[model samples]
Target: MTGENVNDTTGDMLRVEDLSVEFRTANGVTRVVDSIDFAVPRGGALGIVGESGSGKSMTSLAIMGLLPKGGTATGSIRFDGKDLLSERESAMRRIRGDRIAMIFQDPLSSLNPYYTVGVQIAEAYRSHRSGVSARAAKKVAVEAMDRVHIHDAARRADHYPHQFSGGMRQRIMIAMALSMEPDLIIADEPTTALDVTVQAQILALLAEIRRDTGAGLILITHDLAVVSEVADRIVVMRGGHLVEKGSVEDVFSDPQHEYTRRLLDAVPRIDDEIGELRTTAIPVVAEEEKR
Candidate 1:
């Protein structure tokens, strides 16, 4: 879909208002994502969190114009200035992978196993801009991989997705997302499959990319800790509806909703109660003093 001009909306980089999605069941109409209102400013990061079926993924899909067939989406997804629902698929395709892009959770599914990593990245680049030669596109791909700290990017460029480790494959996904240099990047649980350490690395890399490029980010996930580090704002959803929305500190420290409060409490903290638990163990190790 043709992107609406940003000049039309005040302070709205991406505004999703009253977006309702429904699925037709033999039983009746089942609404998956209720009418929800949220916005992301230029260079802003909005984190969405909830349990499964909370409609977080569906919301992102609606925004990306990638919702599945047979699902009816209603409401306004204003990117910059245009209403996305009004645009046709071909129009949206032009914007997708160019002005706007997504990084999915599963790198293996997102990438082509048969093609070289470089080939896929280059293809993505070439699709948007005409006259960008294969060599030039590959150069962009390599540069993007290098930017994400992929070592020997030129050498790894020809490797298939299966050849890379899980973390490396994730880095490749980020590189592809970065290649287009889109105005917005919808990353749906980008670190879910990675180990804790690698998760941090990917999050750090995304934060760095966001800082350096000034691109607005929509991070969709269920982990509060992940969003706590990278998201400026957080929106909590429950049972297909929004329960809470606020800055990271506001939602985590002083949550208004009971669901949000419980989510915050569930997160394991390094200090406070955890520290007390450790202290209890520490006194046992000094039994010699008591003797």
Candidate 2:
């Protein structure tokens, strides 16, 4: 919403410096995201990996200006050259779906039950692009669905969210995000609750989309394996603190933090001779626990 062109590809697409999120309650102030810093280069993918309550999702919400009641975010969230933390809600509304789109973990909860998937996607597009005709917007929706590899997208667009399987529903979410052609996409736990095969497919689709569209991606998840497959860099967080940050290969091969090492250890492995695949899981650390 600043007069600056968000589409400028000169520098990092996003940069967060000393970002902190706090909540004020009857009890007192509690900090959930504490002085964390990271960046996503233009057209690059960054994975924020941490356990539940690590503030990964909260950080994303803070950037989107969707923080819940009593929550406050301080410090810098720069998108292109604009400081989002200082922007008014009105300005953020204009920038959110247009320059920055977010995909949540639960597609069913995000999508409306009564509306057709096409209608939902078209509405999202129209919300950001004023004066766009309904027919044109619908066409964009179909195109987006197809872009995400939804077969027979034109026909599938007419179906309700309930009609689609879990994987298909997630694709609809991605299509909605893609319809706007946002500059940055913040996906929070996008692969959660999906099967291994579908998870791999979705990750591949995300990688393909980034490669094709050159849109910067921030994937927030607990699975190191998922990030290893899709993200170029990884940010490891624990108890609201950044424990480690480096390339995916570096972090996977030689994790600097003990917590990170434990997380990598928790990732399930496959034994070729045994022909068995193990389940993948992340260790849950309590809020008060010190790593």
Candidate 3:
């Protein structure tokens, strides 16, 4: 389970080097992701920011071994010193939800409406952990839900996805990811389509979770505002190329690339401080209310 460090003595949770993704069609080959390099330090947060079709999601999908048909990835994707690109599908399956978890953009589509939220969460947990009783898995599911601040989680577990608000359903997605206690979490536009207040709540919850669990985070989003709140490092992508990479502070203070500067300008509140959006607090529930 141990992995060698990437270009440094300090070990990294995940390291991507010269990764390129391409799709072959009747017309020709299209390279959506050029050779790009980045790393997530253990327990650190890395943000991949870009506009739509900038290959942010494709890079994550490549890391997860979930690339869509007709797409192929080349170069190294190292997770904890292991070369994920070389790993077999079976090995990747074992590592996917168990060691590395992903939070998708749309929780509704990721969840099943026919199943109770608890059932879905428990099933996911059981799939990764063999020989666990359903009752044990269900308990884990409830705990996970509670960990994500889903109020009345034990009762709410029985509710279907539709019964929950958009923010709450996103929390459910996070709960499912937390249930596994993975080493790294890749969240792709997790706050998309959420209201401003709800987005802040979700971001706070994610920051709290990372602090509590010491899990490395990969947050992919187009919003510079969102990443400024949570990420320690920033990677800017455009047309599959890595235009900029640096500490969040440096990137925000003095962007080197024209594209990066444009992205910052596109922020709705460009006048406001960049990293100040993290002040939102996660709501706390009393223990007595759990019953």
Give the top-scoring candidate (lDDT).
3
Model 1 misplaced stretches (Cα beyond 4 Å) = 1-10, 269-291
RMSD (Cα, Å) for all candidates, in order, is 11.1, 4.9, 10.7
Error at 18, model 3, angstroms: 0.7
Against the hidden reference, what TM-scores do the models get? 0.89, 0.90, 0.89
Pairs clashing in candidate 3? none
- TM-score for predicted model 1 compared with the true structure: 0.89
| Tens-digit per-residue lDDT, 1-291, candidate 3 | 222221132787788999999887666777889889998888889999987777899999999999999989999999988999999999999999998999988999999999999999999999999999999999999999999999999999999999999999999999999999998899999987687789899999998888888888899997888999999899998778888999999999999998788777767653353422223211321112111
Over 210-236, each residue of candidate 2 has an lDDT whose tens digit, in order, gives: 878878899998777789888989999
Instruction: Predict model 1's lDDT versus the native.
Output: 0.83
lDDT for 104 (candidate 1):
88
Stretches of candidate 3 off by over 4 Å are: 1-9, 269-291
The lDDT, on a scale of 0 to 1, for candidate 2 is: 0.86
Better of 1 and 2 by TM-score: 2
**Index of the highest-TM-score prediction:** 2
User: Whole-model Cα lDDT per candidate?
Assistant: 0.83, 0.86, 0.87
Question: What is candidate 3's TM-score against the reference?
Answer: 0.89
